[model samples]
Target: MIPEPDPALARSLADDLAAAGYTGARLRALWGVAADEAIGRGRALPARREAAATDSAVAILARLFFLGSPVRESEASAALTNVTIDGAERLGLVRMSSGSVTPSVMIRPQAYVDEHGAGEWWIASDIDESVRPGPLPEDHVLGVGGASLTLAGLQLPTSAARVLDLGSGCGIQSLRARRDSPDVTATDISEAALRFTRLNAQLNAVDGIRTLRGSLFDPVQGEVFDRIVSNPPFVITPRGADVPAYEYRDGGLTGDALVCHIVMGAGVHLVPGGIAQLLGNWEYVDGEDGLHRVRDWIAASPVPLDAWVIERDRMDPIAYAELWIRDGGTVPGTDEFETMLAAWLDDFEARGVREVGFGYILLRRRTEGSPALLRFERVEGAIGPNAALGMHLAESLRAHDRQARLSDAELAEAVLLVAGDVTEARHYLPGAEDPSVIELRQGGGFGRTLAVDPALAALVGASDGDLPVGRLIAAIAELLEVDPDALLSDLLPRVRGLLDDGFLTFAGGEASPSA
Candidate 1:
C-alpha cells in the first residue's frame, strides 16, 4: 500500500504544480485530452506512473495527463503512488477514494493566471464530491463550461456594489461578477458546493466572495441586491418525490417550478434600478403562452420591473426525453435505458408538456413605479454565440422607455436621421414604363433593406418632421395631383412598418409636446 499523504508535502506539490503550466487553459487542455482518451479507449483505468524522474515539466504533465484518464480509484492510486494522492487531496488537487477503487480522482485546474506556458499551473481537484454521487466520472470539476460562460457573457456591464449569484454552481458566475463588483455572495443548496465556491474564489485570486448554503434566497432574506444572477438547476425530471442529489441539474420542483420561483422572487430582492439575469427552461403546457406566464410573474411582484424574455429553442417531448436520457450515460438497447425513457415520456405527457422552451431571461427594476414587459424571440444565428446580444437587448430596452414617453406631435417634429452609410437606391422596372423602385439600404451589420412605396418614398424624402404624417400624405397627394384619401390609405401602413422595423427614430433635440 502507498504511504499516507502528508499535508506539508501536498502543499509543496500544489505549489510546484502552480509554478508549472498547470492552471487555466493548460489544465483544461489536459482534462480534455484525458476525457477524450477515456471515451475513446473505453478503459476504466490507464497505465501507472513508471517511477521516472520528474525533471522536465512536460514529462510531469504527460504523466499526469495519462494518469488523469477516467479510471478506478485503485488504478489511479497505484499509478501515481509516488505523488501521494492523500496529500494532493488535502491540497485540493485530487479527490480520491479507496472503496470500489477504480479511479475516483478528480483534478481541479487553478482558477487564475493569464498566459499558458510551463510553470503556470492553476488546476485543482474538484472538492464538491458530496453534491453529485454517481459512477460517471467526468462530471466532477466545477470548471468553466459552455453554460457558465454563456450566462457570464450575457450579464449587463454596469458595475454593482453588491451582487448575488443564486444557485451558483462552481461559483463561475460569481467569479465573473467579482471582477467588476465590490462584493459577491453566492448561494447554493449544498455545503460542499459552497466550499468549492470558496476554493474557486481563492484559486482565481478573487476576494470577498461569500458562500451561503441554502436553496435560492433562504440565506439572503431581508437583503436586497444591486444585481442578481443564477444558472439554476431547471431541468424537468420524472423522479417525483425522489429527487436525486444532482443539485446541479435537478431543481426538485416539477414543471417550471424553479423558474417561476426565481422570476417571482427576483423582483423582491432587487433594489430600485437593479437588474437580474437568469438562464432557465419552462415547460410548454398545451394552449398556454410561456411568455405570458413569465409576464404574470412579473406583474404579481410589488416592485415594478422591466423584463426581456427570449425563447431560444424548443424541444418536443420525445426529443427532450431522448436527449436527457442519453445524458445520464444510459446506452440505448438496454433495459434500464428503455425504462428511464418511458418514465420521462409518461411524466411529460401526464403533465401535458407538449414541448419545452429554453433561453435567457433578463429583468431590471424600474425607478420607483414604471413596470412594463417586453417580449421578443430571435432564432440564434449561425455566425457565433448570442451572449453579446443580451447586453444589446438591455440597452435597447433602456432606450425604448426613453422613446415611449415622446408625444405624437413631438415625434412628428423629430428629424428622421439615418445611421451611418445608409444609402437610397432607385430600381426601375425594365422598359415597361413604371417608375423604378426606391429602396433604403443599411450597409453595416445585417445589411437591412427596405422597399419604399412610391408615395411613401416621396413623403420620406421631404420629411423634415415639420409636418404631421397625415398632412404630409395630403401634401404629397396635392403635389402629385392624386386623390388625397387614396394616398392616405396607402401610405399609413407602410410608414408604420418602417418605424416598427427601426428604419426611423426621433432625432435629438426633438422634445415631445408633453415634455
Candidate 2:
C-alpha cells in the first residue's frame, strides 16, 4: 500500500528531521561504524544492536525506519514533535497498535552531493528483505538501492526544460532529475509507486515533479522531453507457478523484451538532440552477443540515435538464477530454494540462454548527421568517482558534438590541454636504459589507461595549450626525425580519441557544447 500523504504533515516531518540533524553521516556516527557498513550488506542486526542502546530522536527514527525496530508511541511522538504520533499514523508512515508504533514503511535519510550542492532527502518506500520478515510482496516498492544510485549518478547535469523519469520507483531519479530540469514527469505502472513518489517529493519539499500512472510512455504519449532517465524493472524472471515475480525487479516479460521496448521507445519520447539513460540486463542466447543484440535494438528505432552501451559484467545462467532467487528471500540449503532454482534453470534451458549481461545504456537522438555515433564496449575497470560522473558525461556529450563537426585537418589546428588528473607511467627492464612500456592513465572520467607508442606519448606530453596540435606534431616529428605529415597522420586520430574520452580537452578551442 502507498503511504497516505499529508503534505502539511510531511513538511513538519521534514522540519523535525532537519532539526534532529538526521542525515546519512549523523546516523552513521550515532550508531557504530561497523553497524553502518552492515546495513548495506543487508545485515541489520549490528545496527539494531547499536540502535537499541539509544532512544535519542535520531536513534529512535533510525531504529524505527532504518533498523525496523518498533518504537514506544510517547517517545516517538516526543521525538517527532511536528509530525507527532497521530500525524505519522495519518500519513500512513506508521501503525499504532497496542501502544507501540510500528513502521509501515521505511524512510531513509539519503545524502547526495552534486554540481548544485549537497543535500539530503527523506526517501520513503516499502521495507526490503533486510528490514522486513518473510518474502517480499509482489508489488513491493523499493527504497534507495544500488541500481537507483547508479542511475542517479548517471544522470547528466545538463539543463533541460522538461525531463521524464520512467518507472520512477520511490521517485529518487525524479528528485535527481529535478536538479537539472525545472519540470520533471515521473511515470510508473503502479498507483502505489506513484503515491510514494508524490510523498517523497513532498517530504523533500521539492516542487515541479508531476507524477503520472501508466506503463512505459503510455502516460504522456506524444509528449517530448529534453532528457529521459529510467532504472527500469529489467530483471529477467521465469514465468512459472513456483517462481515469484517481484515487481521491484522483474518487468514481467519474457527475457529482456521489456528492456528492448524501453530502448525502442526512447526515440519516440525524446526531442531532437535529446538523451536517454537507463540501466538494464540483456540475455545472451543461441550464440549471439548480448551487446550486438542491444545494437540491433537501437538500429531498429524509428528515430535515429547515437547509441553508447557499456556492458559492465556478465553472469552465467546458474549464477544469475541463484543471485535473483537469493535476492527474493529464498535462502539456500532449503527445499523451496532448490525448487525455485530449478524453475529458473528450466526457464533458461528452454530459451537456450547461456548468460546475462548487465550494464548502462545511453542513447541520444541525432540532431542531423551523416555519421551518427554507435559505441558499444565493456568497461572492465571501476568507473571513476561517481558524484562527478554527471558533469563528466555532460562534457563528453559536448565534446562528441564539437569533435564530430571537425575534420582531421581542422582538429590538428586546434589547441588542447591535457586533463589535470592525467599522468604518464613508464615500465622498463631493470638493466635497460629505455622504457619498454608507456601508459597514459586518466584519474577521472571512466578511469581509463591507454598504452601509447613513444611518438603518441611525446605528442601528449607537448600538449600544453601553447601550440596547435599540427604545430606540435611538426615539432615532434622534426626532433624525432620522422616525417611531419606521417606523424600527423599517425597521431591526430589518437588525439581525437583522447579528446572524446576526456583525457584531453580544448584549451583555446571551442569544445564546450554551449560554445
Candidate 3:
C-alpha cells in the first residue's frame, strides 16, 4: 500500500527523534563497529541483540524501525512521548497488536556531509531483504544505498533557481539538491516510491519540493531548469517471467535502451547552460565500444551539450547476471536461482552482450555558436567515502570555459600556478641519480596522475604563482639547449590540458587574485 503520511504526526515524531539523538552515528556507536559492519552484510542479530538490551529512545526506535524487531507498546510510548504509539499508527509507520508494535516501514537516520555541510534526515523505505519476511514485492522503495549517496555528493555546490530530479526514488537526490536549489521537482513512475519521497520530505521538514507522478522527463515536459540530478532506474535486468523486474532498479526496456533514453532526454528538458547529471550503465556488444556508443547518443541529442562521462567499472555477462540474481534474494543453489540464471544467459546471448559498463555522466546544454567540450574516459578506482566532488567539477568547468577563448600567444602571456593539492613523485633505479620516471599526482578532485618529460617537469616545478608560462617555457628550453619556439609549441597544448584538469590554474587577467 502507498502510505499517505500525516504531516502533523510526522513533525511530532521528528521532534521525538531529535530528543532521543537518533542518528546514523549514534546507532553505529550503540552497537560496536563489528555489529555495524555485520548489519550491512545482511545479519541483524548483533544489532538486534545489542539494541534489545536497552529501553532508551534510540534503542527503541532502532529495534522497531531498523531491525524490525518487536517492541513493547508501553516502552515505545515512553520513548516517543510526543508522538506515542497511537500517533505513530496515525502516521502509517507501524502496526500495533497484543500490546506490541511492529514496523511497517523502516525509518532509519541517514547522515550526509556534502558541499553545503553535515546534516541528517529520516528516510522511510521498504524493509531490506535481510529483514523482510520473503522476496521483495515488485515495487520496493530503496533507502540510502551506495549509488544514492554517490549522486548526492556529486550535486553542484552553487545555488540554483530550479532543479529537476528524474526517477527520484525515495527522494535522496532531491533532498541533497534542495541544499543549493530553492525549487525542486521530484518525479517517479511508481506512486509507492513517490510516497516514500513525500514521507522523507515531511520527516526532514524540507519544504519547496513538489512531487509529480510520471516516467523520466514526462512530468517535466516543456519545462527548463538551471540544474537536474537523477539516480535513475538503470540496472540491467532480463525481461523474462522467471527473472524479477524490480521497480527500484529496472526501467522495463530491452537491453540498454532505458539508459540511452535518459541521456537523449537531457537535450530537450534542460535550458541552455543548464547541467544534468545522472548515473547509468551502457552495453559493450560485439565489435562496439560502450563509450563510443555514448558519444553517438550525444550526437543524436536534439540540443548541443558539453559532456563529461566516466566509466568506473565493468562486468562480464556471467558476473553481472550472478550479482543481480543474488540481489533478487535467490540463493545460488536454489531451483529458482537456476531458472533466473538461465533466462539471463539467454537474454545476453540474444543481444551478443560482452560486457556492461557503469558510471557517472554530466551533460551541460551549450549556447548556439559555442564549441562544446566532450570528454569520455575510463577511471576504475575508489573515490573518498562521502567526498563532495561538486566543488572540484565546477572549478574544472570554469577553467575550461575560460581557457577555450585564449590563443597560443594570449595563453603564453598568462601566469600559471600549480594547484595546492598537486605533488610530484620521482622514481629512480637502484644506484642511479637521474630519475627514470616522474609523475604529477593530484591529492584532490578525481585523484588524477599524469606522466611528465624532463622539460614539462621543469616547467611545472617552476610554476609557483610567478612569471608568465611562455617565460618559463623559454627558460626550460634555454636550460636544455633546445629551440624555444619548438619547446613552446610542444608544451602549450599540454598546458591547456593541465589547465582544464585543475592541475594548473591561470594567474592572469580576470582569473588573477590581484585583478
User: Estimated TM-score per prediction?
Assistant: 0.70, 0.97, 0.97
Q: lDDT tens string, model 3, 429-455?
A: 999988999999988888888999999
Off by over 4 Å in 1: 1-18, 23-67, 70-87, 95-142, 241-245, 369-371, 376-380, 412-515
Candidate 1 lowest-lDDT run of ten: 112-121
Clashes of each: 28, 0, 0
lDDT of each: 0.61, 0.87, 0.86
lDDT of 2 by residue, 1-515 (tens): 95558899999988888887788888889877888888888899988888788878888888888778899887788788988888888888889888899988889988887888988888999888998767788898989988898889888987888999999989999999999989999999988899899999999989999999888899989899999999999999999889898877888899999999999989989888888999999999979999999999999999998888989999999999999888877789888899989998998999999999999999988876534778898987777545377777778767776777789989988888988989999999999998999999988777889999988898888889889899998988999998999989989888878887898888865633531
Q: Which ten residues in a row have the lowest lDDT in candidate 3?
A: 506-515
In candidate 2, which residue pairs get closer than 3 Å at backbone N, Cα or C atoms, i.e. clash?
A: none
Question: Roughly what TM-score does model 1 have, to 2 decimal places?
Answer: 0.70
